[model samples]
Target: MTTYAIAHLHQTELCAEIVEYLEKIDGTLAPFGGRFIIHGGRVEQLEGKFRGNLIVIEFDDRERARTWYRSPAYQAILPLRTRHASGDVFFIDQVAQPHRATDILEGIRVPTAGVAP
Candidate 1:
């Protein structure tokens, strides 16, 4: 199944060390098939607390997401992110299509929310 990972970073505060730590994580993520669809930017909140950055990453599978997160490189820089900000990193496997239950969901990219279709 295709897995999607959303790494949310709510930076209640930031410091020099935290910026450096995110850099380290960036380097580690490069090797894996990781790409950030969302990063820190200006936006008007439509609902509840919108405090910080939201990072959405697309991975091949749950295993791949887990591997990137648990790998030594990420582990090494994990502390930096923790020290700098309040965040959450999670992966969710999208339900496969009825006709393609045996296949992966990566083939079908779900439309993002807040779109006028």
Candidate 2:
């Protein structure tokens, strides 16, 4: 399954760090077929309030996302994301077909009621 990553920054030196990272550490994701779908750009606030920047990335699967994050290349950029940005970072598995009903169920692991459900 495909996976997506969302990053929202409130007060990060995220831009500068991202530039540095792209220049040097982006190679790690090459093998994983990682791609940038959304970046820090213009956004229209039609709902909730937010500040700083927003980023969204797509990867082939969870493993690639995990690998890219831990890989040396990405790790090299980690400090920038850490020192600069601070908002929300999350990963989600994509659904082949978009459906509101299924969307609600995604990632909702209904644990056995008896043992830590």
lDDT of each: 0.76, 0.78
Give per-residue CA lDDT, model 1, range 7-62, as digits (tens): 67776467777778766766777777876667676878999887778777777778
Clash pairs detected, candidate 1? none
TM-score per model over all chains:
0.69, 0.75
lDDT, candidate 2, 20-74, per-residue tens? 7657645766878888888789989999887888888899898888888888777
What TM-score does candidate 1 reach?
0.69
Query: What are the root-mean-square deviations of the candidates from the true structure over C-alphas?
Result: 8.9, 5.7
Among all candidates shown, the one with the greatest lDDT: 2
Clashing pairs in 2: 12-84, 12-85, 13-84
Q: What is the lDDT of residue 82 in candidate 1?
A: 78
Candidate 1 lDDT (Cα, whole model)? 0.76
Off by over 4 Å in 1: 95-117
